[model samples]
Target: MGIWRIGADVLVCSRFTVSPLAQTMAALTALHKGRADPGRQAWLREHLPAYRDRLAGDRVEELLVWAALRPRWLADFMITPPRDDDRTFHDELRRVSETPAEVAAADLATAIGAPLPPELRVPDLPGRAAALLEWIWTHTVLPEWPRLRRVFEADIVSRTGRLSTGGWAAALDGMRPGLRWLGDGRLQINTYDNPPRDIPANARLSFIPVTTAHGWVTWDLPDRYAVIYPCTGLLADAPTSPAPPVAVSALIGPARADILTRLSEPRSTTQLVALTGQSLGSVGGHLKILLAAHLIHRRRSGRSVLYYRSPLGDRLLKPE
Candidate 1:
């Protein structure tokens, strides 16, 4: 079984509406990171006036960090492999490299040495498009998006008309009741532009000035001071920068030399403990110090912990 499943309702809306914006934002993020695509930039200049401002400075930085980190996660499991006889593998590798979803799947497959099966027909997967929203929510919204979520939901409703497919309508109906206008409005006349006067702001809400693949959306959150969800744990498995070797006297003492030596080859707490014949707690204690010193880094692969010496740590131990 796949590690995830998107509801038909969500998959439908994601196909038509949310995915486009997700792709646009991803591309924009790339632009901010100095990976600008002239075609995308030109498209934004012709279509979205907001990019003229959002691409300026720190906004670009925030977008770059947020956009660059996600999508590949979902890309890992979105499809099953083509039947062994399907000749699509060559096309799959060649055609999908430019699209985020396909590239992500390929990357994951490379890492695990397994093929991802196609969940649907090749022509209808919309894999890159679908990856955009899933990636955004998991990486961008879930972490730093309490305020932005509301904005995105509202703006999506306002802009639902941009989609020609009923897929968007179905997805909205299945959305958290908190953000269902896109689907509900399907029965109304001129819903987004000329809504019934009685529609509440909660119903007529909009995302802030964020731009996406479908174009610009205006759904900023209502308050600035609201507490955001804590994101410390979400990235717990992520890699860290190397620790420094500046010989802080508060911990590890001269064992620092041995600790540094062992870390040159990354090891988990259990592995280190076994290697040193030290207690697990002692190994952990040394690791914390090494981490703080920026001499080592951590990454989680499944249930095990792994450590690696930082480049800085290497420079410190190298003969002059």
Candidate 2:
């Protein structure tokens, strides 16, 4: 049982972020435990074999066993990663390389609660840990990131909507099943194995939604805190490529209908053009009309604008 005390100042200061490195690490943990959402399980069954074939050595697996297998050791090093509009794999690996050595050693010692292993006791342990993360990124996660990111970003958008409409309490309660929102500025989380601890007031809490984490995971660093929770509705249907529905096409025209279907995963205008084989001018025109009708919403990611179907649009597409 962990209770995070939230003062008014902390509540206002806290924000949401998405972390690619966190998701990659969480995915490795899921693979090792063989536990995942049903949809993700099916995805892994199909994709894991190819991912393993691409591994150059057993270094990544060894690191997973040594650092990530248990939650505590990795928690020290996997501090809440800095957020960005277009955070990339290389960018995060660079952050790993920059972790302070003392912090890494202290975290490892505390996590193990015993004498350090011979190999890990070597000088420059931070560099070695960073190297292991880079190896995992290069071999396993980078290839699938494009597909995984869409799920992560979409979850953020949905949660943001909940936060706006019903305030923090409503938003936090919806994140996972067992979370408890005790009124008067406190939130209690049920971490099965972790001992009870109280987070001090005024600490900034970062809530991160991850596609790979099965349940909630937390990181308590100096003045910053983070909770990584599973993304809801991800892989629930595991959409297969399908033709646009005739009824929708007739109602909204073929091009508009095609655009809406492609939004099952968030996509940019250029991506849509490439996928639909439509001219830029034609796609832009359809997008304008769709946006006017509240059938889709757009958000910026780096230089590109991403569009996903709105809740109204989702209802319209449901089969009779």
Best prediction by TM-score: 2
* lDDT by residue for model 1 (130-233), tens: 44334433443344344333333333432343334454443233222122333343322111343333222322221222322222222112311010111111
- Model 1: how far residue 197 lies from native, Å: 67
**Lowest-lDDT window of 10 residues in candidate 1?**
223-232
Candidate 2 backbone collisions, by pair = none
With candidate 1 superimposed using the best TM-score fit, by how many Å does residue 303's alpha carbon deviate from the native? 1.3
Query: lDDT scores for all predictions?
Result: 0.38, 0.66
Against the correct fold, how does model 2 do in TM-score? 0.68
lDDT of 2: 0.66
For model 1, the stretches where C-alpha displacement exceeds 4 angstroms are: 1-252
- List model 2 lDDT by residue over 1-320, tens digit each: 56666677877877777777777777666655555674577656755664455333555335434653565345456544454443576676665567687776666676667655655655676676666566556556677666556555555655666678778776776576556677677777654565555555656677777665345545545566777777663535444547788999999998899899889778766556545656656777899999999999999864346899998888878865
**Which whole-number lDDT from 0 to 100 does residue 110 have in model 2?**
68
Each prediction's TM-score against the native? 0.23, 0.68
